[model samples]
Target: MSIVISNPPYNMKWQHPFFAQSQSRFDLGLPPENNANFAFVLSALDHSEKATFILPNAVLYTSNKDEFIVKKNLVDKNYLEAVISLPGNMFESTSIPTCILVFNKRKSHSYTQVIDLKGKETKEIRDQRGQYGKTNTNRVYKKELNVLSNDVIKEVLSVIESRKNEVGFTKSVSINDIKEQEYDLNPGKYIDTESVDNIHRPYEDIIKDLNRIIESKNGVKITINEKMAKDLEIYDLMQDFKQSKELNKNMNEMLKAVNPNLKIKKEDIAALSRNKEMKFEVKNFERVPEMIALFISMWKQFVMTLNNEENRLLVELRDALLPDLISGDIDVSQNEYDAKEDK
Candidate 1:
């Protein structure tokens, strides 16, 4: 045989019978069983004087032990001549994409040619006569080439003869650069598909979008003390009312203790009055005001986030009733409610 052409048995890398045999020759272990396609490739590379093998696209750029050894063996000796990457759906019965790899032991040319034969249909007429076979399906069948298009094959042959570098679509990469990419033989990685252009977005528009996203983000804590202002005012008012009531109660008590017959008039009393146990007097008025003010200040300090037990209880009650209040679910008209409702 001028050229030995063979399609070996399909076996995965890990489980294949040839893998054990091949590893000993190449001194590299088999690729993972998930992909044994490379094992066949290695076997072909080792055995054939010159070879053309169809392998699944994975064998081109694998970095595993089998792949590393295969690449080192091929490129170190400059065995690989041409690698043609084909398109998907080339194999209709199966979905695996294939590539045509041409290898040679002797150096025919300085540069390697890569041809892309993807995305093209190949057709062959079964019969020249407009007659059907014995099976009664009366149409002449068209058989397509399993591998390369005529145009692609022609280009490949031409490139092999030319031995010159072609850029953009086809690349004749040097052995040194292939070594730099860690022996990765992927054609798409080498080919630059992007077109150059100056594209810029407006700064104002970008800022506006960023601000919108920031505002849309939920659960961000804001340091705004809205309730603090209103609460402080209410606390001051309550403090004044409490102090006035205590003063009025004390004055009434003191009057009664000083003169038993002297009746304290309701009109003379302050607007707020409370019957407290402590004796009320004008002498204690200043002290009462200071104590009430201090209590109000302490209450202000306590008005922060309700993280304590009492504060937690208050918050729970508020939250529990809030939904019902907002949804108008509870009937406030029911007057049977008493102190027991607190329980």
Candidate 2:
């Protein structure tokens, strides 16, 4: 068994320069500033049997064509075995998320193992020693760690042994599938990381929710009706007062037209009203209270009809602003309307 730990000199040239030439043939441009060594590492991985490597994450993923060519060559030759991603705070001195790559030429198992040890039980540093002391001084305790626990490791091993394709978190894909992602080795891209809620709620629960909604709507209607009733009473009183004033003006105009020289005072009106009441001539049914009641009833009916039409118009305007409930044409998730007001 051979293990190659490779981190080539940044400016070193390979023995066979065919891999460097491959970049040009593949139309991938030269690797950029201070980091052209990844091309040689790719060349080494192409020739070696098994290798362990350290690399910047950018080498694995970049929009540049040269990087793509190098990645494509390594993956196409089946040099990649497994990738282990570590937690962000592992490198205390620097601020970079690091990972370890294990590559192999031939494997006895169908899938490789990846154990993350970054957030495991950390040791306390006493003096310059690399060993832990009896009295703990570091921040991390054994209980407050998030390593690959025993149960987690067992589960991963079980899946690897069973060779079953699991969904979410962990899975295996063919080489062609990896190529489809353009040789990016990020687990998030391949893994189905979406949350899936599969539990079915009962019909009774839905009915209860709908009932609550209906009761809330009815409460709103009651409040609106109460306010409208008070407004209606005030509006009717004002309208009656306006109509009475107009009627008195019309009567005065009629009296002046009939007898232009007759100046009628309030006392004279009262005496005339009393004399008319005392005279009490026999009147036909057509000209009595029936005519007056009929005219008043006709006015009330006209007002009611007008109020109903006005309310209908207001309802139509409200409906135009609201979105349709069916088909989900608009997203009303928070019930916020996308309305703009003119200043």
Candidate 3:
């Protein structure tokens, strides 16, 4: 059996004469406008009975029209065997996350094994001298790194060999399911990482945790509200300053109309308002309205960032807890029975 394995350079533009003249291999679709990830895969498939390619994460779920067409074709033809989402920083040259695509031409099932090994790596701190150490110091520069464990490898192989679903780690997905998901091969979309924890705590405890989360979210809301109130007060001050400026302009026009010889200059008004040392301050104060507006814009953006962070936390909590709650893994029956007994 001929097997081809490669880690093709990602996002390379294919403009070579060979690529330009290649027509038969691009039956699925032409290499995308800017990416040749699938083009390399197709070339390998042409020469070998089975091919394994390490590709960037985008290749699995890129929405580019031509890329998606090729992906859909591969799924439809049952050419795709497995897609494994590896952890980040797996390569020294790039920090972009990667995945492995396994293809086979032999007779097999229509389903593909999708594995999510994102967090399977064990994190260790290594010193500048390449020795594993615990404490970080100036001379002993420390770096947190991930390494694939033997058990993770064995588990991945077992799932691929058995074609069984391993909850959050691996799953066998039918071609129809792939099509339903718009040909998205991202393993995280199908696997729920929280489910793998298998935490079977009491529902009361879960509810308490949720209440704390809600309280934290509410605190964020209160901070946002306070910022908004301050913003409104600033806006009102700006409006008042604008009205005062308008009145000063009208008064100047009236003075000019009343006495054609008399000049009602802004500098004259500043000279009358304060001392020589405060002249610069008075001049710069004219720009206070503009400064206020700019400050308000920046403050609003800061508030928006805070709000987005709060929303992100809420989304993460929901993703982590909802599955366990719905699956009945966090038992609620005990709490319900206790309540009834107390009543």
User: Clash pairs of candidate 3?
Assistant: none
List runs of model 1 lying over 4 Å from the truth: 6-24, 27-35, 119-148, 192-343
- Going through the candidates in the order shown, the clash numbers are 3, 0, 0
Candidate 2 has an lDDT of: 0.40
lDDT of each: 0.46, 0.40, 0.57
* Whole-model alpha-carbon lDDT for candidate 3: 0.57
Error of 2 at 113 (Å): 7.6
- How should the candidates be ordered by TM-score, best one leading? 3, 1, 2
Task: Summarize candidate 2's per-residue lDDT along 91-196 as a digit string, tens digits.
Answer: 2222223455667768655444333333342433322222133344544322111234576657655654554444444556556767787776755456554554
Candidate 3 residue lDDT tens string, 1-343: 8899999766666663465545667776776545678889888877788899998777887767988888888888899989998875465333345789999877368889999886588876666432222344335455555678898888887888899987678888888888888888888677655634644444333333333322222221111233344444433333333343344343333323323342212211111112222111212222233223324333332223223333333344445445655776544433321122112
* lDDT tens per residue, model 1, 73-165: 677677777777765434422223457777777766545566655434454333322333234455544433344567866777887666545
TM-score of each: 0.44, 0.39, 0.54
* Ordering by lDDT: 3, 1, 2
> What is the TM-score (0 to 1) of candidate 1?
0.44
- Shift of residue 16 alpha carbon in model 1, Å: 7.0
* Candidate 2 Cα outliers beyond 4 Å, as residue runs: 6-33, 107-168, 197-343
